[model samples]
Target: MAYQLRGGGGVAPDLNPLPPEGGEQAPPPAAEVDRISSLPEKARLRILSFLPLKAAVKLGMVSNRWSHLVNTPQWPCDSILAIHIRPATQGPCGCLVPTHIRSDQIMPLLANELGRRGRGPGHRLLRFFLKVDDAQTRPADFYSLLDYAADCDVEDFYVDAGLGPPEVSFNFQRASHRLLRLVLFGVGVNQAHRRPMSQERSINTLEVITIENTSLGDLELKWVLLLCPRLRTLVLRNCRVLTCVDVTAASERLVRLTVAECPQVDKISVSAALGLHSFRYIGDLLRSVALPPTCFGDLRICFTKATLVDPIQYHNWLDALPNLSNLVNLTICSNALKIMSALRNRENFQTQVAKLSNLQNLRELRLVLYRMNTLMLSHTYGFLRMCRCSRLRNLFLELPKARTDSFVDAVNGLAEEPAMDGFESLVKVKINNFQWQCIEIELVHFLFRKARSLQKLILVAPKGTNPERDQSGNAIFPDLNLLCLEKAPANVEVQGAQLVLWL
Candidate 1:
């Protein structure tokens, strides 16, 4: 048949076909097996070390060689444990898996993996990270794992309990002396363990601590500060029970402190501490604050409440300004401005200007303007006149999207008003949410004419609109330079959207 089909597309005869008679065949030798498996056990473990915990666990099932390498009686790798726990999503059918099963899957897998590996005597642990979802059933096995990590003296401990009411408390009483940082979310200190542990040892090794969305009262916070003598950074966010923050002890070592959204915090007192470099607060105005005389290089104070019925009540609030003199950068929100406006109107504006004159070292000033139903032009100009920064180089003006035409006119009037000293030192100005209105154009013209030393003008238009082209597809504010070409310096540059204009 092969000879008859020679004229057509002929099939090539197999030269190495199986023998005609059934014959036994020998398997390939072991030497020709996978090269990776042939590598040294340490080299294989090194490769597995880079894989995530999930993948590393999955690797044990690959082959006998890999199984023995990773799942032996005692792992030969260095002591490093990293655990990431999150809620298991539903399967493709959209059926929710039982929380017990989800916990069973992760907890035992980790415990077993670490059981043999961490059994070695004098094992040096590196880090421990536990990020768990707010599932109702937080298994006892999970706490056991945390206890194990704590016992092992893990260096870095981070726990984020996602968006749930606090059901569990973490006892750091026996926390490792080697722990350098502790960040907790939705987890509070165990009150039962606080008294005994607070008496026994202090967390002198800790350098940073952050707590958020947890119920921590003044006593608990003060206890933490007293414990962590070397703490350099402390961040408290939306903590419900933190009514008062008095940082006299930690003030010496703390370089940065941020308290945000803690509305109940009625008072903050930080005595003379030269090491403090930055302090940021975002909530209701504190009843009182006493900052260090040395001053913070960067200070940010925001008020949660928007309205101020009586401007005269802002006297005490304005008194907080001069406490910090050497400001490299300062950010004041609408609340501060409102109070400042009240102060300006109350005392002929000179006292308010003098209060801000202490900011001789100010380099950058950022002001946020929001729904001001009764804001006056004099109030705006008064604040500007107070910023007599010899080194003032940058100014950022941010206006809310809901700003009215009257506000724009007020700003224009403020810019038109003369100052004792013009913005000679000002080199750059950034206007955020630029409306490109007639009043805004006039204000730009005024700034260009007065700020002789101004080098760049940056206009950040509102988002969702083409910066280069407006909603109608026309060039955005085509006459930006034309409006001030005569008064603007020849070297001045106007930058808006993606377009740049030069006079």
Candidate 2:
């Protein structure tokens, strides 16, 4: 049978074959017809709906008929448009070569696509994302896209300017009411543009707002919260210019607030946020934090490198511990415990530990360590003793790579210490970046003696470490005799890289 290329680059048996022996060609057999191309238009659209916009666009290269079908007014893809402007590549001579999609062309291209979709009830855009790597991207271009998105009634919008020069300033007063989520990176929020909106005209539909690496201030953030009466989550990160985040007027619907790496932010005040359940801060200790007496169920505090050297900062962090009595889950760094141990006054150290014991509701605790030293085991034991161990169910400890000499010293130093009380209610414990060293073995033995209720213990090897063999094909497993597996409780199960003990 002869074949011919079909509209979608598929082969089909020829229906009209050349006559043989001068006889009229038999009527084309009904069973040898193309089936997919003959499918109903709605069915074809349903097939296209399952594909992404890029895949659907590739169909236009198949054939003219398929191209027309893909570009029809009823294009099946959800109304999502994303354009990422790639950075220039280095040429052989060390010169920079621009990418195919120039930054300047983005505005016109977005306008054309949005224009083709038209505007109105059924034509609303579900989401639009734009990221420009070029530092020369014009501020007008960003504002134009924002205006177009508002005109098109886009629901979710994300714009990342790559922390370029001359940050793009956003005016939320004109935001679309249909906007549900907005994420801006390296974009500024102009305080002058934040005018009070009428009660009926506010963006009550906005639920989540995240701004990072910008110059957002306390008043501006408060203004944003006031403008969005129904906002639920707000995250501000790397905003160096932010001096304070006062959410005292935050809406009752606000549930989570995160402020990370904002070095200049010295205070966070939350008073009447009834729905707030989680709060996270990552940076130097704040001068003051006025949290509600209750309602927060989860809290996380991670100190930056500067906190380790600044005694006053870590002391401020220790001072804030007693206020978090309502937290059900808490995540902190080992540096806090190390700092607590530095206090020369025994009375002050005990007072700090007594304050930490107020976390009676803490069920899950995560400790991130920056580095390991001989004193770490003692600091860890002191921290665990301060927490309500009978109520703590999950414990996660992330260890850092350490020198062999340091590990040896730690093992020897802790070998003579008395065994601590066991965790009665702890069910699971995970240790990350576990290197099979003397100190690690000693720590495992300490946990075996303690954590009597531990049902599962997981030790994850450091990233890039070989499980079976070293790079030279030598076996990487340590001497199994050193593990002392007999110390593990009968009810406990140990799991790790290629090593699982049922004991």
Which candidate leads the pack in TM-score?
A: 2
lDDT of 2 by residue, 155-181 (tens): 778888864436577778667768888
Error (Å) of candidate 1 at residue 250 is 2.0
Worst 10 residues of 1 by lDDT: 1-10
Model 1 lDDT, residue 282, Cα: 85
Candidate 1 TM-score to native: 0.69
CA lDDT of each prediction against the hidden true structure: 0.65, 0.67
**Per-prediction TM-score, please?**
0.69, 0.70
Residue by residue across 145-178, what tens digits does model 1's lDDT show? 6677777766667776654224666776767767
User: How many steric overlaps does candidate 1 have?
Assistant: 0
Q: Least accurate stretch of 10 residues (summed lDDT) in model 2?
A: 90-99
RMSD of each: 16.8, 13.1
